[model samples]
Target chain A: MKQKNDKSRAGRRTFLRTAGKAAVAAAALVGARSVGAQDKPGTRAAAGPVEGYNWNEHRWAYGIDTYRCIGCLRCVEACKAENGVSLDAHHFRTWVERYVYLEGEETARVDSQADSQNIAASGSEKEYRFDNRYKDKKVEKAFFVPKMCNHCSRPSCVQVCPTGATYKTKDGAVLIDHEHCIGCQYCVQACPYGARFFNDEERVTDKCTWCYHRITKGLMPACVEVCPTGTRIFGDLNDKESEISKFVRDNRVQVLKPEQGNAPTCFYIGLDKDVS
Target chain B: MEQLFHVAPYTGYVYPNETVFPWTVMIVVYPYLTGLVAGAFTVSSFYHVFGMEQFRPVSRLALLTALSFMIFVPYPLLMHLGHPERAFNAMITPHITSAFVAFGYFALFYVCLLVLEIWFVFRVDVVAHAQNATGLARQFYRALSLWSDDTSERARAIDRKFMFVLAVVGIPAAHGLHGYVGFVFASLKSREWWGSDMMPAVFLFSAIISGVALLIVLYITIAKIRRVPIDEACVRGLVYALWGFMMFTLLLEGVEFATLVYKGKEGIDIILEYVAHDLFYRFFVFQFGVGAILPIILITYMVFRKVRGKTFITVAFICGLLVLLQVFLMRWNVVISGQEIAKTMKGLLYYHVPVLGREGLIVSLSALFGPLVLLWIFTRVLPPWLDRPATAGPQ
Candidate 1:
C-alpha cells in the first residue's frame, strides 16, 4: 500500500507540472498574438493599457483640486506616519501652501506653513499672523495648494544620479533604490521641485514614492485615505472609471513649473498663476 | 538640529527643505583647492610648453605645488558625502549623463599626468642622489629612479623630451580639472545663479589668476626665508600674468551679470533682490571691491611702471595675497550665494558659517592646510630648487 501511494503521488506531481507548462505556453502565444495584432496596419494601438504584468498595466496619476484643500495638515501628518519620516519641519514628503491675494495686488503673497503644529487653526475664516510680518492683510481671496513630487516623465534626479540608484518605475513613479544610493546629494540639487532630500539617518536620498508599497498592494496611499475633503485624488490613469481619470478629463488641470519641461504627471485644478 | 534649520534667516516663501543650505563651506573649499592646482599647473606649463624662460626658475616648484594640492582635492568631497566609503561607486558605476560622473576619471587622469611629469623632471636628480647616498635613503632614491642610475646626456635628453610631452598634455588636463568643477555647478539647471554657459571659461581664467598669484607669494616668501636673491624678472612676469587673467575673469563675470540684469527673465527680480539684500557685503565689497579691484590696480601699476626694488616686491606681494582672497571669495559667492537664492524664486536663504562642526570653517581650514603640510613634506623628500646641486643631500 505504501509503494502504491508513492507511485500515485509522483504521477500527480508530473501531471501538475505538465499542465502548468501548457498554460504558460498558451498564455505566451496569446500575448504574442495580441502584440502582433497591435502592429498590424491600419489598426490603432490601445490608448492606455500596456499588455504585461500588473505594474506595467497601470499608469498612476495624482490630481489636486486647489479649491477644495482646507489646509488641515492631516494628509501631511498621515504621510509622515506612513513613511516613518522624521518629525523635523525641514524633512517632508508632502506639504501645504497658503496663498493670500490682497485686494488690488498683482502678485499674490504665498507662504507654505508646513512647519506649524497648529495648521487647523489658520484658514479663510480666521486671519492668522505668521513671522510677525504676515498680519491679517486687507483680505481679498485665499486658497491652499498642497505640493508633492510631480514624478516627471523624464526625471532630472534620475538623469543626474552618478549611480543608477534613482529610477522611474513602469507604473510611472520615481523611486530611489536606497541600498544602492551613495548619498552624494546630486539628486537633491537636480530636482527642480525640491522633492528630494537626504535623510541623515537612512544615509540616502528620500522623496515621495507615491506611496508605492500600499499602492502595489491594491490599497490607497495613506495621505489619500486620511484626507477629509477628498481634495487629494490618487488613481490609475489606465482605468477610465478611476476618479483621478474622470477629474482630470472634466477639469482643466495644470502642472507646476511647466517651463521646466519635466512633464509632471501630478495635475492641479484651479491652479493659480502665482504658484511656482 | 531644528536650531540649525531655524538659523537660516529667510524672507519669503522658501521651500522648507531649502532653508538649510545643502552644500557648505567644505564644498567651497573643494573648488578653491582644485583651482589652485589647475592654476599652478598652468604656470608650470608656461615654462615647459610655452617656452617662457622667466617661469623656468619656479617650474618644478609649481609642478610640486600642483601635485600636493591635487592629492588632497578629493578629501573635502569625500567628507561631504553621506557615505564616504561608497564614493568610489561614482567611478565603478558612473551614470553617463551626470556631470559629476567625470570627477573620478578627471581626478585620476590629472594626477597620473602630474606624477609622470614630476618623475621625468626629477629623474636626473634622483639618479645622482641614489649614487651618493647610503642605506634606506639610497634605496628609496634608487626606487624613485626606477633603479636606473643613468645620468648620461642622452638619458637627460630623453627625460626632458618626456617631461615636455607630459607638460603639454597636462595643460588641457589642468583646464579640464577645474573646468569640470565649474561644469558641476553650471550643469544644475535648477539653480539660476550657477546655470550659465560662461561658467567653465570664468572658472578656468580665475584658476589661472589664482595660480599665478599663489606662486608669486610662495616664490617671494621662500626667497626671503632662504635669504636667496629674489628672481625679479620672474616675479614681474607672474605679476603681469596675474593682472591679465584677473581682468579676463572680471570681464566674464561682468558679461554674465549684465546679461542677467538686462534680459529681465522671470526670476531676475528675486535674484537681484537676493544679491542686493543678502549678499551686498560679501559679493560686492569683498569679492569685487577689495579682493578684485585693489589687486588689479596695484598689479597694473607695478606692470606698466617698470617698478622695481623693495617697493615693487612689496606691492606685488600684497597684490598676490589679495588675488588669492579674491578667488576664494569668488568660489564662496559662486557655491554659497548660488544656494542663497531659493529655486522657488520667492525668497532668499541665508547660510551661517559654523565654527566647529563637520561642514564648518575649522574643517575647511584643515582641508586647506593639509595640502600645505603635504607640500612641505614632499619638498623635504625632493628639493624643488633648480640651483641646488643634484648630488646634494636631502634637507
Candidate 2:
C-alpha cells in the first residue's frame, strides 16, 4: 500500500510541472506576438487606439506665410466665432500683429488689432495706419505676423499642468481637458509664446486647440479655413506630399522663440529676426 | 492710449493677452504668508535644536505664530484658483514633473510636523488643564491631551527627546515649504524676471528676516500691552540675526540684478525698462531705500549703541515694521513685476488693485490679518507664556 501511494504522488508532481511550463511558454508567445504587432506598419498597438480617435495615422502641423498675410484679421474673427472665445482684448486664442520696421531702426513697432471692428475698419491696406508712432518714421519694411498656440512637440503648458489636464494628443495638438483642469494657471505662466489664458467664464485654462473638433473630422481649423490670402496652411506633416511639409522643406521657415526649445510645429515663412 | 482694465499705459506693442497680469496682489500675498510660516518655525527650531538659550522665551510663541500663519496660507491660493472646488486634484492626481504639484505634499507634511511638535510640547499643560478644569472645558482639554494621562518623568523625558527630533526634522521641512514656494515662481523659465537660480535662496533668507522681525515686533507689542518688562538680550540677538540675514538677502538680490545687467540677456533690457518705468517708485523708493537701507541702518545703530528703554524699543519696533514691509514689497516686486514685462519683450503690462472684486485688496488684507486673529484665539487657548510654571500631573 505504501509503494502504491508514492508512485501516485510522483505522477501528480510531474503532471503539475508539465502544466506550469506550458503556461509560461504560452505567455511568452503571446507577449512576442503583441510586440511584433506594434512594430507592423499598419497594425494598432495591443493597448488599443486612443478613445474616440485613431492615433496611428493623423499628425498635424501648421504653416504661416508672413509675406502672404495681408493683415485682414479674418482668421481672428473666424476663430472667435468658431471657438466662442471671449471678445475681451486681453483674451485671445489667435491674433495678428502688424510689424512696422523703419530704416536704421533696431526695433520694430508691432501692433495687434485685437478688436474685430478695428480690423474691419482698416480693411486690407498694404500700410495699415494702426499706430501713429510709426507713421512719422521712414518706412523700411513691414509685414504681418499672425500668432497662435505653436502646438509644440514639447509644450511647457502640458509639462507644467499639475493635474495632467493639459496634454498633447497623439495627433500632435496640445489640448486642455477642461473637466480635469483645476485652473491654477501654471500653464499660463509656463507658456513662452503667451498662448494660454485663464477663461474666467469657463473656469478653465483656454488656448488654441488647433480646432481639434474641426480637424479630427477632416475639416480645416477656423483660422486656416477663413484665411482669404491662403497665408495660414494646416495639414498633416506625417504625409511627405502634404503642402505644409513641402513648404517647410522648400522655404527657410522659422519658429517664434525657437530659443525656448519647445520644438514648435508652427512654421513661418518670411520670419524676421526681430519678430520675437 | 486709454487705460484698459486699469492696466498701466504702454508705449510699445504688447501682445493683447499680455496686457492683463493674471496674477494679482492675492498671489503676492500667498508667498508672503508662507514665508512668514517658514521663518517663524525656523526661528523656533533655533532654540529647540541649536540650544540658542536667548530664543527660549519666545520659542513657543514662534511656533504658535507659524501654526497660525500656516493655517491661512491656502486661503489666498484657493481664492486665486478658478476652480477652488477641484483644488485637491493637485494632490489626488499630481503630475510628476510639475513643480506646483509638490506644494500640497510639502505643506501637509510641514503642517503635520508642526502640529505634532506643538502637541508634544504642550502635552503636560493640556493634561493638567484636563484634570483641573470643569465642565466642557475639561472635556476639551482632555481631548487635546489625546486622553494620555501619563505625565510622569519618563513621559516628559520622552516628549523632550521627541521634540528634539521633530525640531531637527522641521528645519529642512520649513526650508522646503518656503523654498518650494520660491521654486513655483523661479522655475518658470518663460518669465525672465522670475527665472533666476538665486530666487530660492533669496526667498528663504528674506523669509527668515521677516520672521525674526515679526517676532521682535510681536514680542515688544505684547510686552507693552501686558506691562511686562521686555527681554533685552532676546531682542538684541534677534535684531543682530535679522540684520545679518537682511544683508545677505540684499547681496543675493543685487547679484541677481548685476548678473542680468552684465549678461545683457535678450529680455533683460525690457525688464529693466519696465522696472525703470512702472516699478521705479516701488522698487527703488519703498523697497530699497525705506524698507531695506533705512531699517538696516536703524537696526545697526540700535545694536551697536547703548540705546535702551523707549528709544531702543521704538527704534527696534520701527525697524521690524520696515523689514516686514520690505519683505512684502519684495514679494510684490517678484510676483507682480515679473508679470509686468511681456514674454515678447516688446512691451509692459500693469496691474491695478481692485478694491471689492474677488482678487481685490479687501480680500487680500483680510487674508493677511486672519492669521493674526487666529493667533490671538490660539494664545487664549495655549497661552504661550514663559512665566507660567511647568504644569505638574496629578500626584
Candidate 3:
C-alpha cells in the first residue's frame, strides 16, 4: 500500500509541473505577439505604434541670442497680431522686459526683443545709449530677456492642476485646453516662472503657446518669423540635425531655475546671468 | 541696442523674480483660512460669551472647523513661497520686523488658546461622549483631556478661571492673527495698490462679514442635510449682521476709490485705468455686481421684508459665495495689478495669460477643492450642529 501511494504522489507532481510550464509558454507567446503588433510596419522591432510617445518628441523650443537682439519690438508686434492678442491690461501672450545690473568697470545693456522704436528712442546700439551714466563707462549693465513660458518637461502647472485642463503634448510643449479649464488660476500660483496671465476678456488664463498652431503646420512661431536678426531659434531639439540641437550641443546651455527640477526643454546658449 | 550680454558665462543660477503666484495665492488662501477661523470662533463665542446653551449643538463643529482651517492656513503661502522648505526658518529665526513673523507667532498662540478653551468647554462631556465613541475617537478625546477625572469643585473653578483668561487673550490674538495679514499688504511700500491704512481695517471688517456669512450658510446647510429644524431667529439675526457688514465694506471701498481717483496719487491714475477699462469685468462684474452688490441687495430685502426659512438661507448662501468671490478678486487685482506695472513704470505691458500646461488654473482650483472636500468629509464624522440630549433623557 505504501509503494502504491508513493507512485500516485509522483504522478500528481509531474502533472502539476507540466501544467505550470504550459501557462508560462502561453504568457510568453502573448507578450511576443503584443510586441510584434506594436513594432513599425517595416522593422521587426518597431513595436506597436511607438507604445508611448515621448513628451520630448513634440516640444518646439526657441532660444534667443541676446547679442543679436537689437531691442526691436517686431517680435512682440508679430505675436500680438498672429495670436489676436488684445492690448488690454490683462491679456499678454508675450512681452519684453529690460533689466539693469550695476557692476564695476563694465556697463552692459540688451533687450530680448529688438524693436525699432526702442532702439531709435534709446539712440545707441550699445549699452551706453540706454543708460545716461554709462555714457563713457563706470559699470552699469542693462538687458532684456523677452520672457515667456519655459515649457518644462515636468511642469508644476501640469502636475498640480486638479482638472487636468493644462497638459503637456507629446512633443514636450505645454498647452492649456481652454474648454476644460475652469479659470481657477491655481496654475498661476504653482508656476515658479510667473509666466501665466489671467485674461479678463476671455475669463480664462493665457500664456505663450510656443505658437503651437504655427509650428505644427511646419511654420515658425510668430515671434521668430518676425525677428530680423534670427535671434530666436525655433526647432525640435530632439532632431539632432536641427539648428537648435546643434547650437545647444556646441554651446553650453542654461535654463531658468535649474534647481526647481522642472527640467526646462528651452535652452539658452548665451543667456545673461542677471536675466535668468 | 546691439550690445551683447557679457557676464560670467551664465550657469543658470540667477534669482528669478518671485512669481506673483505665491502672493496671489496667499492673499486668497490667507483670507479664506482666516475667515474659517473667525467663523468657527464666532460660533463658539455664543456659547462662551453669551452663555447660550442652545449653541451647544454647533460648539464642537465650530472648534473642529477652526482647527482644520488653521492647519491649511499655511498651505497657500507654502505653495507660493520661493523656498517652501525654508518656511519653518521664519519660526526659528523670525524676522521680528516682518508682519509675516508676527502672523506666524499669532497662529501658534491662537491654536494653543483654541485647544485649551475647547478642552475646558468639553471636559465633562468628553468623558460622557467617550463611552459612545469607538476606536480612534474614543482614544483621541480620552488622551486629549489628559485622563483628568476632576469632578471636584476646585477643579471646576480652576478650569473656569483658565478658560476665562484664554478667552480674554484669544480676542486680541484672533484679531492680530488675521489683521496682521492685512498689515502685510498694507506695509508694502512698493505696491500702490495695497498702500493704505484702510486695508487692515477693511480686511478685518470683511473678515467679520465672511465669518458670519460662512457660519449662517454652514448652519443652514447642515440643518437641511440632517433634516433638523434650524433656529430661525439666529438665521434672521445673521442676515441683519450680513447687511450691516456688507454696507460697511461697500462704504469703505467707495471712500478708498474716491480718494484714489480724486487724489490722483502717482500710482492711482494708472490703477484707475486698469480698474475702469482693463479690469472692468473682474472688478465691476464679478467683485461688485455679483459678489458685493447683488448679495447685499438680496440679503437686505430678505432681512427687512421678514423672509423666513429656506428663502432667507438661500439668499444668505448666495451672499456667502459672492463675498468669497469679492475677496478672491480683491486679492487678484491687488497682486496682479501691482506687478503689471514695470519696475521702471515706463514699460506698461499687459500680463501674460497662463496656459493649462504651466501652473495656472489647475493648481488654484485644486487648492480650492481641498477645503471644500475637507469641509464635506468633516461633516460626516462630526455633526455640524451639536447633538443635545432631551431634558428627560439626560441632564
Candidate 4:
C-alpha cells in the first residue's frame, strides 16, 4: 500500500508538471503569450481556498455610474482622509477630470485636464455655457470623468515584481506587500495604465489596495462611502446579487483597453468615450 | 551656402506630445545596465590596477563583460526614445546644460580606454597572424590596429604605458559611467523616490556588487569550458571582492534609509508607508533577506573557516546571481513604486503585472540572455581572458 501511494504521488507530480508545460507551450503557439505566464490553476489549488487567501472566491470590484456622478468632489476628500494622501497638487489618491467641448456654427474647441479639484464651483449654468448658443441652442459640450486605480484582474505590476511583493489577495483584490519591496520599480514600467506609484519614505512601491483593509471587513471603500450621488459602487463581484454585479450584468459595461487583454475587473457602466 | 546650411526645421514633432515610454521605465533599464558595467569594470581593476594577483584569471573577462554590456547601454535608451535617430544630437550639438551631456563624453572616454587596453594586450598576436584571420575576424583585427606599426619594441612600450594609464583612468570612468546613470534618476525633481542625494553612491556600490559577481561566474564557466584548471586562489579573492562590495552596499543603504526615515518629509512618509508594508516583503525578504544577507553569511562562514572547495565557489556564484536579481528588483521598485503614488494627491494607481506578454518575463530574460550571447561571441574571437600566459615563456 505504501509503495502504491508513493507511485501514485510520483505519477501525479509528473502528470501535473507535464500538463503545466503543455499549457504554456499551447499558449505560446496561439500567439497569446501573456496567457502562459499566469499562475497555473494547480498553483492556486494548493492554497485550499482559505478565506481571504482564495482571491477568486472573494472578488472585490468597483463600478462607476457616469450618469449619477455629481462631480461634488466628496470622494476625493474622503480618500485623502483615509489614506493620509498628501495635500499638495502633485500627489492624489483620487481626482476628477473635466472635458470641455465647444462646437459652434463655424468652429469647435475641446479641452481636458486630469487634475481638476474645484469641479463643484461650476454649476449647471456654467456647465451649459459652453454647449449653449442663443440662436442654435448650443453651448459647451463638457463632462467629468473621475479617474482612479482600475485594480485590474491581470495587473502588469504584479507580473514584473521578481520578489512577489505585489500579489492578488484571495478575494481577487490586488495588493502589494511593502515590506518585501526593494524600491526597484519594475512594476511601474510594466503598468499600461500608469497606476503604480513609488513611496519616498520607505524606498519602496505603493499603489491602490482597493481598500483591502476595509473591504475585507465588509465596510464600503472610502471612495464609495463618500460618493454623495452613489456614483461609485463597491461589492463582491462574484455575488450576482451584489449591486456592482447587477449593474454590470444589466448595463452595457466596458473595460478600458480590452485590446490590451488585462481583463480588468473594474467596470464602468455608462462610461464616456474620451475617458481612457 | 544655402544648401549646406539648410538643416531640417526644428518643429520638435520628432518627439510626441506625450511619450509612450514613461520616465519610470527609462530609469529602470538605464541605471541597472550602467551599474552592471561599472561593477564589471571594477572587478577588472582589482587585477590590473591593484594587482590583486588572485583575481588575475578574471581580469580579461571583466574587461570584456564591461565592454559588451556597455554596448547595450544605448539600446534600451534608443528603444525608449521617441526619435531614436536623433540620439546623435547628444554627440553633435550637445546641450552643455543638460546632465545627459556628460554621458556622451563618458561613453567616448571608456570606449577609447577599452580599445587601447585590448589593443595593447593583443597587438603582437594580431600582427603575427593578421593574414590568417578570415572574414570579419581579419577585418576586425586589421581595423583594430588602425594601420599602426606592430613591431616588438613598440608593442611592449604601448602595453606598458596603456596598462598603467588604463588602470588609472578606467577606475574613474567606471565610477562616472554608473554613478552618472544614478545621477540621471537622482536629478529628476518630479519623482519623490529618486530625489535623494545618496542615490548615486548607492547605484555605484550596487554596480560593483553585480559586476564582481558576473565576472566570477563568467570566469568559472569559461575555465570549465576551456578544460583549464580552475584557479582556486583567484576564485577565493573574487569572493572577497564580492563580500567587500556587498558589505559597503548594505551599510550605505542602511544609512540612506535611516536618514530618509529620520527627516520625515511629506513625501518621505508616503514613500515609507508603501515601502514598509507593501514593499517590505521584497525589500527585506528577497533583496536584503535572501539576495544580500544570506550570501554574506555564507561567504563569511567560508572566510572564517578557511574552507576552500568547489562547493564554496559554487555557492558564491549562486549568491552572485541572486545579487544581480536582487538589484534588478531594486530597480523595479524604485522606478514603479515611485510612480504608484497619485501625483494629484488623491488616490494611488495600482500596477498589475501583465500575464505572459512581450514586455513580461520573456523580454527581461532576453535582455539578460542577449548579453550572455554577446559575451560568448566576444570570447570566441576576442578571447576575454589570457589562456596561456603571454609572458610565461615565448609564444
Candidate 5:
C-alpha cells in the first residue's frame, strides 16, 4: 500500500500553477458530478426478462407471520443451500429469532440459530438448532420471528453504498451486483435491521435478496418454499389478487421498526413490541 | 489465509449478521490519521496564512507533517476495503445519495491543495539543491522544483503569495476533511452511539488539539536531535494552542456525552451499561482523566506559575504526548465502541483484536505510527528546519 502511494506520488501530474489566485480558485471547481453512470434513470441496473415476466410490471414484497412459525430451522437450511451463503454462525441471509418469555420474566429471552450456544448444540456451523435452555423453563409464551431483508422503499443500505453496487430493484427486492461491490461494509453498518453481512470469500456485502433469482422466475423464495407452516409470504404488491395484498388488507400489519421511516415492504403480522 | 472472520462474543441478543463485526481497527486508525493531517495543516497555516512569527520555526515542519500524514490518509481505508484495487470506483461512479460519495473529491482537492502549498514553500530549497546537488538527488530536486531554477526575489514573492493563498484555502479544506469524517459516522441513523449532531464539532476541536500537540512533540524532538536550542516562543505558541484547544475538545466531548445520556434514547440502557463497565477505565479514566485532565491541569499550573525554559518544555512535551493519546482514545471509543454496541440495543459485542494478519494488532499499530517514519524520511529530503540559523544556511 505504501509503495503504491509513493509510486502515484512520483508520477502525479503537475499543473505548474505559478498563479496564487488561480491555484486557490482551483478548489472552487471541485467535481460535483454526484450522480453515477448507473444512477441515471433507465440505467439503474434494471432487471431483465425471466421467460415472459417483466420486472416493471411487478412490485415484489414479502410477509412474515410470526404466530405460525415452528422454529424448525428448515427455512434457514434452505436459504443457506439456495443462496450459497457462508456456512458459519456469523453470516445469514435469513434466520429465525426465538423469543421466549418464561414465567415471571419481564422480557423475552431472545436467541437465534446463530447464537454460539445454538451453534455448539448443533455441533457445527453448517447446521443450526435452538438449545433446550428454555425447554424446561419457558411455560408462559413463545413464538419464532423469522427475519430477512425488509427491502425498504428507502433502504438505508442502498443510501449508504459508496459504489452503488447494491441497489433497490424495480421489482421491489434489494439486490447486489457482485461484480462491483468494493465491500467497504458501509451498507452493513447502515442497516438498522442487521440484515447485511460482508461475504469474506467473495469480498462483498450480501444480504437476503428475497431470492430475486427464483422470484422473477415465478417461484417462491427457498425459505418460503421450505417453510412448514406457511410462516413466510412472498408475492407481488402490484397484483391485488396476490397473497401479500390480502395479507396486508386482512391483517393489522406493521413493518419492523417503522420509526426509522425506511418504509419496509416486508409486512409482519403478530409482531410484538419486543421484536426489534 | 487470514481467518475468514472473527465472530464477536456477545452477552444478550444481537443480530446474527452483526457478529461478523463490520469494521476493524483500520476504521479507527483511518479517522485518527485523517485527524492528524487536519491538525498538522492548521499549525502550518498559522505561519503561512496568519503570519505568527512565534510559530514560524515549526511551520515548515508542520507542513511536512501534514503532507506526510495526508499522503497516507487513504491507505488504512484501502486496507479495510474488501477489494482495495477497485477503490477508485467510488470516484468513478459515486452513489450520489451516499454521505461517502464526496470523499473522493474532498480528499483529492485537499491533497492537491496541501501539495501545492508544500511545493511553493520548498521551491527555493529545491532550486538551490537542483543547481548544486549531484547524481540522482540533483535530478530528483530538479523535477521536484518543476524544472524551474528561479531563486530571485520576484520568484520568492510569488512563492509567498501562492503559499498564502493555498494555506488560506487549505484551512477549510483541512477542517472540512476532518469534519466530513465525523459526519460520515454521525449521519448513520442505525448506530445510536455515532449518530450525534455534535459529532463533527467534537471531532474538529479534538483534531485541532491533536495537531497542535503533535507539533510540540516533533518540534522539540527535532530540535534536540539537531543539537539546537529549542525556540522558546515557538514552543510557547504551540503550548497555548494545545492548552486552549484541549479545553474545548474536553468540553465538547463532555457535552456530547452528557447530551447522549440526557436524551436517553432507545438504546440508553446498554450504552449506560457499557459506559459503566468496559468503558469506565478506557473512556472515563484513561481518555478523560489521565490523558486529558491531567495534561490540562498541568498546563494550567504552568501557565499561572509563569513557567519557562526546560521545565516548561518538559511539561508541555508530556502534555503533547498525553493529548495525542487522548485524541486516539476518543477515536477508538467512537469508532470501535459504536460497533460494539449491538444495533438491536439489547447487548454488547466484544471486538477481539486479532494478534496478526490483515485486520490485526500489528497492522493497526503500523498504520498508527508509520507516518512518523515517513515524516523522518521527508525531513531528510526537504529539511523543513528553515528557522534555525545552521540548518537554514544555504544548501
Candidate 6:
C-alpha cells in the first residue's frame, strides 16, 4: 500500500511537470518563429526549442563544489565564448568569486574576476583573471566560489516580467524570450542573485540559460565542460544513478540564500557563511 | 550620438551585472508626476465630490492640472524604455502576475474619465462660442461641442449629473493608479529598501501633499500673472488640505523608515550605512527637514495666528514650493537610492546622471516640466476659471 502511494505521488509530479514543459515549448516556439531567428544548426543558442527533445523525460539541475575551485576563471572565459556574451567587465554569464579572510579580520573580503583591480591586472576585459592583492598577507582562509544563475523554481524575474518575456522551464532553466522582450529591465532588478544583466547592444535583458540548446542536444554546458577541477557539475536529477542525484545523496548539500525562498535548482557543497 | 551604457562606480563585492542601473532618473520622475496627478485630482474632488464651497475657486483649475499632468505621465516611462516602439506590449500582452499589467488600462480609463468630466464642465462655453464665433475659432468650438449648441437648463442638468458621477468614480481611479505605482516597488522582495507593506500608503499621502502644494503655487502664480485678486478663502482651504495630508505623509514616512531600521533583517547593516552616509542630505536634511517638517510648522503658525493678506500668501507659497521639492527628493530617494544599495548587500553603487542623451539630465527635465507647457496650452484652449468668463462670446 505504501509503495502504491509513493508511485501515485511520482505520477502526479510527472503530470504537472509535463504540463509546464508543454507550455514552455509552445511559448518558445511562438517567440522564435515570430522573431525570424535564423537557425544555424549546432550553435548553443539554436533558434528555437530543440526538436524531438522531450522536456518531460529530464529534470535538470546544477551542482558546485567550492572546495575544488582554484579561481582559474577558464569557465568564465569559456562561457562567454560559447554563449556569445559580451566581453566586458560588467556583463558576465558566469563568474568566480574569491573570498579571502586575512589575520584579524572576522569577515571575509570578497571580490570577483570582474573587480576593477583584477580587470586592470588582466589588462583587458576580453580575458578574465583574479588579482593577487592578498598574497603577501597572512591568510586565515580562502576559497573560490563559482557563481551562475540558480534557475530558481520560483524565479522573481519571471514573476516581475511585465510582458511575460522571461520564463522558467520545466527541465530547470530560466530563459528570456528575446524577441518578445520590451526591454524594461524590471526582471533585472527583481533578480536577487544579480544573475541577469541588460544587453545594451540588443536593448534587452540577458542571462545564462544553462546553454539550453546544448543541453537539449545532450551536450554539457560550456562552464561545466571547461572547469579544470570538476568544480561545476550538471546532470539530470530524475535519473537515479545520475551524478547530481549521487552527489545529493552522498554529501551535505546547501543552496545560496535559502532564506530568499527561491528554491534554487543549483546545489552547493562546502558553502561558507560568507558565500552570499 | 548616444552612449550605449553607463556603468556605475561601486565598492566591495557587488554583482557584475549590477554595474549598470536598470531604472534611471526618468523612473524617479514617473512616480513624481503620477503623485502630482493623483494629488491634484484629490484637491479637485474636495469641491466636486464633497461639495466644499471654499475649494470652488480652484476646482476647475485642479481638474485641468490633473488632466494635463496625467497626459504627460507616461512620457517619462516611454523615454526610459529600451524599445519605445514596443511600449504598448504591456497593454497588448500584459502578464497577469505582474503588478504593471493594470497601469496602462487604469491610465487610459482615468484619462477618458477626465476628458468626459472636462467636456461636461465646459459644454456651455463651447456651445456659446460655437453660436457666436467665426471662421477657424467657430469651427474649433463647433467641433468641440460635438455640433450640439444646447444651453437649456435641462441639458445643463444632465451635464451636472454626469460630471458628479465621473468625479465620484475618478477618486478611486486616480488614487489607485498612484498607489499601484508604490505596489510595483513594494512587491519586489529582492531589494530590502523597497520591500515594505507601508510603501503604497506612503506614496499616496506624499502624492496628496505634493498635489495640494502645486495647486497653491499655481493658484497664487496665475492670479499674480493675470493680475486677478487672490481668493483668500480658496488659498486657506488648500492650505488646510495640504497641512492635513502633510501630517499623514510625515507619519507614514517616519514609521516606514523606523520599521525598516528596527526589523534589522539580513541586509540591515548595509541599509543603515546607506541611510546615514549616502542618503543623508537628500533624504534626511532636505526631504524631511526642509520639505515636510518646515511646511507643517509654518502652516500651523499661519493657521493659528490668522496670518492675512500677503503674509498668508507668502507663507503658503513657500510651503508649497518646499513640499514639491520634498516629494521630488522622496521619489529620488526611493527609486535611485534603492538601486544604489546593491542586491549583494555587501556593497553600494553610485549612478552619475549624464547631461546629454536620451536618459540624460536634459531629457529628464523635459519629462518633468513638459506638462506645464501642456497645462499652459490647456488653460488657453479650455480656460478653467470659474469667477471669470471663458474667452467672452461675440455677444
Error of 6 at B188 (Å): 0.6
Residues B1-395, model 2: lDDT tens digits: 31223344455667776765678888999999999998898789888899899987788889999999999999998988889999999999898889889999999999999999999888887888888899999999999998998988999899999999999999999988898888889888898888899999999999999899899998889878868788887887788888899999889988987887788789777877877878888988898889999988888787678787788778888999999999999999999888878888877777778787677889999898999999999888887877446532332
lDDT digits (tens) for residues B284-378 of candidate 1: 88888888898888877766787888999999899999889989999999998888888888888888887766677788998888988898888
Q: On a 0 to 100 scale, what is the lDDT of residue A166 in model 5?
A: 86
| Model 3: per-residue Cα lDDT over A105-155, one tens digit each | 342343332333344655642211222334565445554565667898988
Alpha carbon deviation, residue B77, candidate 5 (Å):
0.8
> What is the Cα-based lDDT of residue B9 in candidate 1?
63
lDDT score at residue A250, model 1, on the 0-100 scale: 72
| Pairwise TM-score winner, candidates 2 and 5 | 5
Model 2 residue A86 CA deviation (Å) reads 0.8
* Cα error, candidate 3, residue A36 (Å): 47
The parts of candidate 3 lying over 4 Å away from their true place are A1-276, B1-22, B52-59, B134-137, B151-161, B346-360, B375-384, B390-395
Q: Evaluated with lDDT, which candidate comes out highest?
A: 6
| Model 1, residue B352: C-alpha shift (Å) | 1.0
Q: Which stretches of candidate 2 lie over 4 Å from their true place?
A: A1-52, A114-137, B1-9, B390-395
**Going through the candidates in order, what fraction of the true interface contacts does each contain?**
0.58, 0.74, 0.03, 0.01, 0.83, 0.76
Model 1 alpha-carbon drift over 4 Å, by segment: A1-54, A114-136, B1-7, B390-395
The candidate, 2 or 5, that scores higher on DockQ is 5
Query: Which sequence of candidate numbers ranks them by DockQ, best first?
Result: 6, 5, 2, 1, 3, 4
Docking class of 6: medium
- Across B78-134, the per-residue lDDT of candidate 4 in tens digits comes to 643433554565566544544565787898888888777766655665654455678
* Candidate 6 displacement at residue B353 in angstroms: 1.1
lDDT values for all models: 0.79, 0.80, 0.59, 0.61, 0.84, 0.85
* Quality class of the docking in candidate 1, CAPRI style: acceptable
Backbone clashes for every candidate come to 0, 0, 38, 88, 0, 0
> Each model's TM-score, in the order given?
0.88, 0.88, 0.56, 0.57, 0.92, 0.92
lDDT of 4 by residue, A36-129 (tens): 2342221232223334543556677777766655566656545544554433333344555544444553322222212222223233211211
Q: What is every candidate's alpha-carbon RMSD to the true fold?
A: 13.2, 16.3, 21.7, 23.9, 14.8, 7.3
